[model samples]
Target: MTNKPDVSVLCFEGHKVRVLQLSGDPWFIAKDVCQALEIVNHRMALKALDHDEKGVNLTYTPGGQQLMRIVSESGFYKLIARSRKASTPNTFAHRFSNWVFREVIPSIRKHGAYGVPWALLHDFTRRSADSVERGSQAGKALVIRKIEKHQLAHEEKHLLDCFQPRLALGGESDAE
Candidate 1:
């Protein structure tokens, strides 16, 4: 198995921000961070901001290799600041900045990974189980309906067969 870099996803207001530790510093995916901050044009925003440019080759499951651009910690801050300035409704930018500064960065510094909350995992599992149960019930109901239809068809055929001899005789004339 190829050893992959230690990467973690931080949930910032329902947005997944991917962070990777490279050379003992936290580097974030430019696109993810930009998206969380509600930046419209990533290329234009990055071009306007003064930030370091770096790339990493990521192995995607079923997609082979992909190149992702990452920004240094300072670069990320610069981008955020730039985005905050450009954003009309600055709530997203503020929230993103607070989340990074208060939760993500501290978690990374202390544990080397952003610890995902257990509640989120538990909720996800419960929902998945409920969905599976509902699907199974629906499938069973469908099968039962099909079986009932088949039995009804069989009964109808039996009734038709019982009258077949009578109908055959009635259609013939003695003079024929």
Candidate 2:
């Protein structure tokens, strides 16, 4: 299995919130959590927080690694409380608070990870498998084209050897 860090994006009422698992605790990306709760000025909002915010390096797909400011679970609830007090409508904050308390936190407590329901996980797995299969097929075609043009038998072996790791992921079968 690929030793990738556990990072997940959750959607709350059309907002994308990014969460990271670090050292056995879940951390929320400050900006993302703020955005989900409709907090306009994240910097100002974070200032009212009683807990010290922390910065950590997280992998950003298609853009390499980035340093992100994050908040602990308690700090996250504190931000929610602050948001609920500050928001004019309060409905969004209430809804978000409910979802986190009823669903998100419970899942984390029980599963040791953000509990993505099985249906969602299954859909994600299916899509990921499709994408990987397509990529592997495309890669195989390109490798074949290159091998044909260069007539390099050893290079073909080396290329196939490089793909071995990906093939081991179980998305695609070995291509001879």
Candidate of highest TM-score: 1
Candidate 2 clashes: the total is 0
**Native-to-model Cα distance after best TM-score fit, residue 164 in candidate 1, in Å:** 11
Model 2 clash pairs are none
Best by lDDT: 2
Model 2 TM: 0.56
Residue 120 C-alpha lDDT in model 2: 59
Estimated TM-score per prediction?
A: 0.61, 0.56
lDDT of 1 by residue, 22-106 (tens): 6556667778878877788988867765534544436332245567767777878778777754344557777778777788778
Which stretches of candidate 1 lie above 4 Å from their native place? Answer: 1-4, 49-53, 59-62, 85-90, 115-176
- The Cα error of candidate 1 at residue 134, in Å, is 11
